[model samples]
Target: MRLLSMITLALAFSPFAISQDPTTQSKIADATQDVVPSETSTQPLDFWMQKKLDYSTAILRGLAFSDFDLIETNANQMRMLNKIEGFVRNRNPEYRGHVHAFERVTDEVIRQAKQENIDGVTLAYHQLTVSCVRCHQSLREAE
Candidate 1:
């Protein structure tokens, strides 16, 4: 009985148990591999932008398959990028607004991913893309 209880408890808390399905794990691995940069890359923008694009692609793939684990992994990556020093450093007021909007939308994506809400995640992802476009346009106009 004690052995049975221990096995049950271990299964409940194990990361492997949570994502134990081979198909799901494969999708997650494939999606992650699609975006991660080679070790030699050093530019912050290049790293973050690649990650952003990778995560966006992962999210779409996850949505197609109803793979919440893939969505959560990529959403967490986006949230991690929000903490990067370069991502937060902006002196221009308009650009700062765009940054804040991006952060907020990314947070929403993370939240929705955690909740496994496909519609919410999709909506937040769209908002994040719009924020990126708006920020880029502002930068071009400034230049």
Candidate 2:
């Protein structure tokens, strides 16, 4: 307990633990604003997951109403998210592979929508859902 307390006290006064210089702090804040939101520590890990749910739900809504525009829009969002995932670069190859699969499935979804092929869209969506589930499962197993 004494050693831990001494270490804690040492860290408390450490340069990284406390900002003694106001100018340095302001500079840090200014630099932070230029970073990608996803690269920021303020972003929650599940933030991307929430986006996935939203876009996927929107795609479902499109299917329910036979709205090709909605389907394409959501699929485009998914493709964008996939690109972001690439930029974020999950070092786990499994996650990386799933990201690629997501892009391919999303492309298929957009293509099906463009062709006005509801059946093809439905099939592609099933594949996309399966891909998402499998990716999540792999992550869980890794954990």
Instruction: Name the top TM-score candidate.
Output: 2
lDDT of 1 by residue, 1-143 (tens): 35334433543455843654776555544543443333334645466567777778988888889788777777755654443322334648887787678878888887897888989988988898898899889988999
Please, what is the whole-model Cα lDDT of each candidate in the order they appear? 0.67, 0.73
lDDT score at residue 54, model 1, on the 0-100 scale: 76
Candidate 2 RMSD to the real structure = 14.1
lDDT of 2 at 42: 77
lDDT, candidate 2, 100-135, per-residue tens: 998899999999999989999999999999999998
Residue pairs clashing in model 2 are none
Clashes of each: 0, 0
Best by lDDT: 2
- Residue 19 alpha-carbon offset, candidate 2, angstroms: 48
